[model samples]
Every structure is written in structure tokens, then in C-alpha cells.
Target: MSEKLRVGFIGAGLMGHGMAKNLVERGFPLTVMGNRNRQPIDHLVSLGATEAKTARAVAEASDIVFLCLPNSAVVDKVVLGPDGIAEGAHDGLIVADSTTADPTETKRIGAALAEKGVAMLDTPLTMTPKEAEAGTLNVLVGGLAEVLERARPAIACFGRNIFHVGPLGAAHSLKLINNFMSMSMVALFSEAVVTARKAGVSVDGLHELISAGALNNPLFQKVMDWPLKGDASGLQFAIENALKDVSYYNRVAADAGATAPIGATVQQIYALANAQGEGKTHVPKLMDVLGRLNGL
Candidate 1:
């Protein structure tokens, strides 16, 4: 509630915008940058939040800056590029990066911030865009206990569940593993459904039976639910993002001297989808691709 705790958001995409709105509604001094998607930016402005002209401007205007970028490349550019936060950041500024990113890069940024007395918390988030809009995101945080404590209230504004997973980069590592599991499940189910349809089983019946059985999962209800209703585009999450996450997951596993055979195979399927130019399509688009492959 003091003037020293202003919060700024660097990305205003699907999840970023919702989190920013929650901060503003919670009475936090909020500043946000505009993105390619202007609707969310405009909405946040309507909520009594100021619009920042650039990533650095957001950092310069606030005490804590949150980066919700898509990947490490964008995160690097925003924090280290010309007019980046590292240049404009005040001493002791707390940066909470919510991107699902590489742990090594996270540590690199955290170490850089340390010299200036700034703190970095790699707090990646999970949940669909719908959950983000509902302020029910699950945040996995990795940082010093005291730093995470300082970030808790702001994090709680947008996340219904928040876990202090471990030290720096731990949250990102766990996020990669979690996404790999999710993507792998979608791929596995896609293959099974395609085979079932070919064998004269009803897709809707299979879904219903599975939902009533042990093989069911929340994602089946989420991605496949409306697809069952004949609305192909209701999921809204693209395969391109899934592929990106799996690729990141691969790197994390390789770094840890581990091999993820299932994850690796799912990445290949996603790679095939990308090659077929379905990268922009949602995860459920796999059904469309599978149907084509089956000559359905």
C-alpha cells in the first residue's frame, strides 16, 4: 500500500493482461507495456492502469517488474537489449519472471541483477488462458524465501495457488517437466482416438467412457470437450506453443543428464505438425491432422 511497491508488467498477452488486471483491481500501482495484441492493453488502461511506452519504461516506473514473455530469446532482449530493464532498473528492484524459460538463462539474469542488489524470482505459471482470466493460475516460484515472501501478495492477486518450489531456476525446471507431461498426454490421446475411430468406435463414446474411468484427465475435458461439440477452434491454444514448450523441456532434460523418451517422441509429432503448417493451430488440431492421415 506504500508508494514504493509499484508493480509493472512487461508483456500484455493472454496471461499477462489478466494478471495485470488483477493487480490493478487489488489496488496495486500498476503500469503495463503494450503488445501486438492491443485489446488487453486497452482493457488494462480502462482499469486505471498506466500504459508504458517500452519494457524499460515499465521497469523505470515500478519497484517490481514482471516478465511474462514467451521464451528466453524475448526475455533476453527485454532485460538486456537497448533500453532494457537492466539499464533502467533501480537498485533493489525485484524482477519476477513468469515465463517458462531455461534455468541456466534464469540464473544468468539473476546473477546479473545481484550486482545491482536487484532480485530475480523465476516463477513460471500454469493453467489455460481461461484460468488466467479467472485469476486462478497456479504459480510455481523459485527464489530465496524472503524474496518469495515479498512477491507473495502480488502473486496471490492473480494466482489461486502459489508454491515456493525451490531456489533460483527451480521453478522453470519444474515447469518444463510439467509441460512435457501435459503435451505428451495430448499426443498419446490423439493417437489412441485416431485408432479408435478407424476401428469403428464412436469418438464421443470413447471420451464419455474414459471420463467415467481411470484413464480420464482434466485436459480431456478441456481440449476435447468442445471439440466433441463440433466446435474445432474452441481450445484456442496453438500447437506452435506446445512445440516450443516441449523443445524447452528437451533442453532441460538433456542438461540434467536425463532422457525423456515419451517427451522426445511427442516433440517429433509436434515437429510433424509444424512441418505440415499446422503450427498455428490448436492442440486439438491434431485430430484434424490424424483424420486426414486416416483418409476419414
Candidate 2:
């Protein structure tokens, strides 16, 4: 097993497919496990990656492994369960997880893997699937200095601006803070647009005016463009993950003895949107929910 830093990807979703392709194209011997969604897995395999039958096979075949999962629960099962990576990974193997998760769970995973002679690095990513496909995702990392240095090259394939934020759980902490603000903005923007429409302003005009001046951002552009173009792919991001981040963000804020009323309110809004069966649509689809409520 003296291979040249072979890599394995445990998830091949919207983000993982591109990241794995980038690694394979760059000549890293890559292995990827097939997920329930076969398209991305097939795409990665076409790029010359070996397909592993299970997470353990991926662990047995690589010196470095990356997990781009949905949340801490999936991450826990893949890394700590019976046939998990930790169960098969050899000494000095590095497992880097790019999932947004609870800080305590991250710390617990780190400690458990450390006992197995494998180090766990939490390097949560930020941005949309488009950014991920473009290899411009931002990475906020937390880990030992040595492990971070060793993982930097593979991480570079997918992340444009990578930062070693701090140690252990710092990256997840910062990621929670960042998404709190992001989800809060979604709630605020949806309310503003729907309320403006009720007051006789067109949604397009509102987006144009605000986006041209002070209230514009990448988030604003993406959300406004999606529904405005009449494209509801249900892929922009879901209310479920949004609410998950909100819950983690609120918990983080509370533990620090700080209060964020706006974020709290937005969490409830997303919860309401999920209750209305819009949980699987883009977060911007909340505009429709708000629209009906405002009688627009």
C-alpha cells in the first residue's frame, strides 16, 4: 500500500462528482463508491476512477478519503459504523469531511478516529453546486497543522480559496455562522419581494433595483434568477438543509450567550415552508409561500 497518495470519495452528489473528477483528471489514483443517485457516480467513473462497492473498500484502497455528505448523521454512520472508513483505514490515513455538522459531533469523530491512528479533519465547504462544478468552492478547514498540509493538494482541486480557519471544530463553527446569515437573508429577501409585489411592484423590478445597488450579492442573484427564469429544478437547495443549518446556527449562538432574533425567525419560516410541503424545492421557492400569505 505504498501508493502515491491515492484518494477516495465516499459521496458523489452535486459537489462530490466534480471534486472527484478534478482529482482523477489531475492523475490522482481515485476510487469512488456508488451512491443511490447513479448519474454522478457514472460521471466520475467515466473520468477513470475505480468504483468501490462499499465505504470500507474505499478506505482500504486509499491513503486519503473525502466525505461530502448531507449532514452529521450520515457522516457519523460512514465514519464510525461497523463497515466504516475508520474500521478499515490504516495508520496515517487522513479522512477529511466537507459536511456541515454539529461541532460536538465533529470533535467526537476526531477523537474516535485519532484512536484508530487515522486523523479526521473538518473542512466544510461553502457555495452552490455551480460553484462546486466550477472548482471555486470556498473551504474553511479545522485540523492539525500537519494533516492540513498533507490534505491541501487534494483539497485544492475543488476549493479555490482555502483557509485554515483554526483547530478541530472551528471550520464547522464558522460554517454555521456563515449559513445563519445566508438563510436569514433568504427569509428577508422573500418577504421583501412578496410584500413589494402586493404593493404593486413587479418582482423583476424589485430585483433589478435592489440588485443594482446596495442589496445585491451572489445569493441575491442566484435566488432571484432561478424563479424569475421560471426554472424550478428543486436543486438550488432544500428547505430541510436550510433548516438544519439554522438549527445548528441558533444552537451555536445560544451556547455563546449571544442572540440572533432574525436568524431565529428565519428558522421558523423555513420550518413553516417545510410544513407546507415545499421542503424539497429551492430555498427561493419560499417566495411562493410568502406570496400566497401576502395575498399577492
What is the alpha-carbon lDDT for the whole of candidate 1? Answer: 0.85
User: Model 1 segments beyond 4 Å from truth?
Assistant: 1-4, 232-234
Please list the residue runs of candidate 2 whose C-alpha ends up more than 4 Å from where it truly belongs after superposition: 1-3, 232-235
Per-residue CA lDDT of candidate 1, range 202-276, in tens? Answer: 888888899999988777776576447766454666788889889988988888899788778889899889889
- Tens digits of lDDT, candidate 2, 1-296: 33457899998787788788888988889999888898988888888899998788899999899999998999999998878898787988899988888887899998998998998889889876777787889999999988988888889988999999899999999999999888888888888878878888788888889878977887887677655886645237788889999988888888778978877888899999888898887887888988887775
Best TM-score goes to which candidate?
1
**Model 2 score (lDDT):** 0.86
Candidate lDDT (C-alpha), each:
0.85, 0.86
lDDT, candidate 1, residue 219?
78
List of clashing residue pairs for candidate 1? none
